[model samples]
Target: MANLQESNHQENWENLSQKTNDSLIRVRKVLTLSRIILIVFLVLLVFLFLPWRQTIPGRGTVTALRPQDRPQTVQNQIGGRIERWYVSEGQEVKKGDTILLISEISQPYFDPELPQRLQEQLQAKQSSEAAARQKMRATEAQMSALDRGLNYQLISAENKVKQSINYVKSDSADLEAVRQFYKISQQRLERYEQGYKDGLFSLTDIETRRLNVQNDNAKLIAQENKLNTSRQSLLNAQIELDNIRVKYQESVAKAQSDMGTAISGQATAQGDIAKLRNEIANIDFRLGLYVVRAPQDGYVIKTLKAGIGENIKEGESVATLQPKEPLVAAEIYVDAMDVPLIGDRSEVRLQFEGWPSVQFSGWPSVAVGTFAGRVFSIDRVSSPNGSYRVLVKQMVPVPAADEPWPVQLRQGSGVYGRVILNSVPIWYEIWRQLNGFPPSLEREPKGDGEKAK
Candidate 1:
């Protein structure tokens, strides 16, 4: 029984060996295919380790770099009615060249000779103002003469008053002397009469004494009257002096009042003259505005107002202008998330509209029909689309077939652009993209003026 069992086990082992050999032989193709796949994976990994230049793509319109170089509208400061059109649309105009001739429709400047009329008014008022000044001066002179005349009269009146006072004093002394003489004569007469009564004096001597007394009394009375007349004269002299002063003061006051009136008239005339001058100047300026001229050298693109007799309001748009020789640039908008990676003076490659181009963002050196540019400015705030605007100017010449961008590129044309950033390993970039991570900066950005050249 042991010998039989050993024989079966040996047969089973032989069968198992045969099956194992066959399985090994048949799986060779599968093992070869696995080895080929591993080699291919390793090659792909090596390629991923290469450097890749990161870029942010954007789309925008071609525009001028400077605001003044962009398209603009021409208008007048004052309102008017169009009388004639000097140039039509698409006409090339030099600065100060007349494009339209307008007439003043506003009532204030309706007169064709408005400036001349205002000038005449100004001259008339100026002449009036001059006459008033002359009158004012004459009034002042009159006032001075009145003062001198009044002073002279006051001096003369004072002298007369002094003379009257002296006369009054002399007359008083004479009256007193006359009274003394009369008293003495009366005493002598009384003594004579007593003597005559006693038959000791003659009648003729008494009569003579009486006559002397009468004459003395008459003289005294006359002297008293003279004294009263002198006192009255003194009073009259003083009154005359006071009246002269009052009269002269009134004259001076009247003269001063006349001068004031003349000055007021002169001021009014001067104000009117100034107003007329200003109006004349305004009319002159408005006359120039009647001929609407080009503000700068440009081409008239479109007329905002049409036809003769069309009324235009102040500061209304007259026509559109496109300045000659604009500094061409690309106005691009990029995602807000990608704006932080872009810095001033960053390198940009642009493909303008209507221009055939091939681009490789990671390999800019291999690009075709694209021009090199630099970031000139970036908007601080995001746009309505949650993107930021970036202004890109050509730093290098655009090798277009005919001319450069400044000459050949038209404003408002579409453009596609790529802003270049840091260079990183392709493997890392792929990983970041796969994991949804933001791009990294390999180095610090340049200063605003550092790479200006």
Candidate 2:
């Protein structure tokens, strides 16, 4: 019985060892298959999806080729009511073309009053000048008449003085003759008195001689009185002559002064008329600033004030104009995370709106329907959308052998592009992304080592 039990135990142990060997073989086969499948999947992923050319993608819009190529706004320089419009929206116009007409606000017929007032002022000045001239003429005539009267009076006074002097001379000569006769009569009386005392002459003869002497004395006295009267007349005539000369001089001076004053007044009146005329001319010039004209040759993009009767203020926008020809540009925005990958003059690939495109990130040579471009500028600050702005310039298209080039892009059309960056391995990119690391960790190259300084 002991031998049989030992035999059963040995057989059971051997069966158990054989089952364990089969299970180990199955486990080894399963492990080997899993390794082979993992290797194949990794090789396929590297070959297909790993990007060989790292790029930063961005979106943008088509814009004018240059900033100055954009539309220009036209404004009214003065406030007025629109009278007429010569051009409409979208119309082509040449430089200096009349664009519109504006009329000044209506007045109550007396608001300006400048023209009527100027006319009235001019007429009044003219009338005043004429009156001044007439007064001057009257003054001159009066002066001439006074001059003639003074000349006549001066001549008469001179004649009277001459006559008085001559009379004085004649009276002096008569007085001398009377004095000689008196002396002779006194001598005769003395002779008669001596003869009477010596009885050589009669008494009657002596008395007659005495009477003659007395008569001679009386005649001498009368002659002396006449001389005095003549001297008085001469003095009076000289005084009258002096008075006439003084009066004449004073009148002449007064007349000349009055004439000068009248002439100056006339000149002032004429000056006032000239000044009024100049003011009227200035008023006329102010009325010519009501018309508006185009400042340059362009096409009207939009009309801000289109109503004919609309009132517009000074410096208000009236219309928008666009140049006849304009170049195209792309305005793109890059996210903050990808902005460090872009630089000025960086290589770019753009796909326009309405155009189909296909991109092979690893092999850009096989890209289809996409145009080449370059990054022209990048914004220093983020925009309101939290993205950095970028401007791009499109390079000339090089179409495939059997493909046609894209049509011209319109302004403000949607666009998208890729900013090509430094080349990197697919595995590294994947590892970085999985670990929440940046796309690239390498520093930018400094040009000629100058940036370090």
For each candidate in turn, the TM-score is: 0.74, 0.49
For candidate 2, the clash count comes to 1
Tens-place lDDT per residue, model 2, 251-361, is 878888888888999999989988888877866764664667676777888888878888998888888877665667788888898887676777677888999989876
Number of the top-ranking candidate, with lDDT as the measure: 1
TM-score of 1: 0.74
What is candidate 2's TM-score against the reference? 0.49
Q: Candidate 1 at residue 202, lDDT?
A: 92
Per-residue lDDT of 353-442 in model 1, one digit per residue for the tens?
A: 888889998888678878888899999999998999999987755434323453578899999999987778898888888997767866
lDDT of 2 at 402: 22
lDDT of 2: 0.80
lDDT of 1: 0.87
